[model samples]
Target: MDLGIIGQAAGLFAVTNIDDILILALFFARGAGHPGSTRRIVLGQYLGFTAILAVAVAAAFGATFLPESAVPYLGLLPLALGLKAARQAWKSHRNGAGDQEDTRAEPGGGPGALEVAAVTFANGGDNIGVYVPVFATAGIGGMTAYAVVFLVLVAVWCFAGRFFATRPVVARALARWGHVLLPLVLIGIGLLILVEGGAFGL
Candidate 1:
């Protein structure tokens, strides 16, 4: 195992995924009233990130067989997701719900693992852009090392997010500001991905 590759992968994942901490923290705070929310969040994050990793691996291996140029256009996925989030937030505001997250509660009907996974995937679609290039260049050994480290770091991220939400100040702020910030963050991520991927010459 190359410690260099492992260290690099860990750092990259941690840096690129800092926004995930905020999202997870919101989830933790919102779901605090619901039992098993933490478990669902953990499972959902893993499922979502695994999908991203699978796509990276596929793109890496299929680089020769596929059009590499099309990879950048994959930014559309996040762009669409961000738009959808904005629409939802708008609808929530129009409906006078004030906060979408607060409006989603139900007795034993909180967001499921799949719901969280979907949000995770949408939020992290840009990971494909970053991961695919790294994976393609890393070869199988380095890819494996990156994957192991990334997954471990993901668990650590989840724990940290949950911990952050436990703070009274953070929890109150998230509750007050998270709905508005979430959509804007998603849109910003989409634009960043597009620019980084050189999509449409951006």
Candidate 2:
């Protein structure tokens, strides 16, 4: 196994899925004190993420049929997404809303595993956009490595979310920094993809 490829896979997963931590934290927060809520949340997360990966993998397989020269154009997806996220963050900051906590009311009952899975899948639009191009570019071995790393990281993300449920301070910090960090990392990844792919002669 190539350590460099593993590191790249880890980095890709980290940047693309950073926003999930906040959502997971919220889910864990709401599910607290409900019987078996934790189990359901984790299971739902896995189910949803697996579905997302399946779609990405399938799409990537299709992407492989595209002209090699055109494949690099897929980098535009992440670049656009990063710019959009950055714009939103800037707007929120200008409106003095960047630091505001999520104040949405918790649902009446613990969300079932399927319900959580739905939400997770719903939130994965960006994931698909990013994953498809990356997976298409990665060969089978590299893609397998990425998949394994992603699955392992899902557990870590779940643990972090659960921990943040009990630690509002840490969660708040994540919220504050995440807005700043997410866009930067995404943009960087976008550029890396484009440059490495020699997109537009860059």
Candidate 3:
């Protein structure tokens, strides 16, 4: 394994994925008391990231698995999720559930793995754009090396998110405001993705 390739892969992954830390932290905060939440979150992240990589690799090889024009529309995934979360929060507040609702077990264990994966993939539009060119230039060996490093780094990223969410002050704050902020954050990210990608010509 060439050190240069390893370094380049690490740099690319770091640049593309720095934003993921906050998103993952919010997820951990939301799922703090739930059993198996950590596993689900991590699994979802890998699933989503793997999908992104697959698409990038396919694109790099001149395979038209996903049209470039459709990339921006991926924002819809997070947008819909945000709207759903917001509606649920509003109903909970209207019903006076308040803080108690925060710890309530969701119907399917508080955000299924697929739900998390959707958000992860939605947030990765830029990752796909950046990765395609690099993957195109890298041969088989190089691509394999990059993939291994990327997967390892995903675990590190998850650990960092979990660590941040577990902090005393951060946890308290998230416990209080996570429900409110989660929807807003997801909405904001969705809009940003749409606008940045020029989705719907916005």
Please list the C-alpha lDDT of all candidates, in the order they appear.
0.76, 0.71, 0.86
lDDT (10s digit) by residue, model 1, range 102-145 = 64654454445776676677666667768888998998899999
Indicate which candidate wins on TM-score: 3
Model 3: per-residue Cα lDDT over 1-202, one tens digit each: 8999999999999999998998888888877767888899999999999998888888888897988888888888988988998997787778786555555665445666898899999899889889988888898889889998999999999999999889999889887787788888889889988998898989
TM-score quality measure for candidate 3: 0.93
Segments in model 1 whose C-alpha atoms lie over 4 Å from true places: 63-107, 187-202
* Native RMSD of candidate 2 (Å): 8.7
Q: Give the TM-scores of the predictions, in the order they appear.
A: 0.73, 0.61, 0.93
The weakest ten consecutive residues by lDDT in model 2 span: 98-107
Q: Which residue pairs collide in model 3, if any?
A: none
Residue 103 displacement (Å), model 1: 8.2
The clash number for model 3 is 0
On residues 1-202, what C-alpha lDDT tens digit does candidate 2 reach at each position?
A: 7898889888988897787786677667646656688899999989988987887888899843335575555556556655876786687677675233332223444546875675565456457778888888998988898899998999999998889867878656645576665556556656766787798899
Shift of residue 117 alpha carbon in model 3, Å: 0.4
State the local distance difference test value for candidate 1. 0.76
Regions more than 4 Å wrong, model 2:
63-109, 168-202
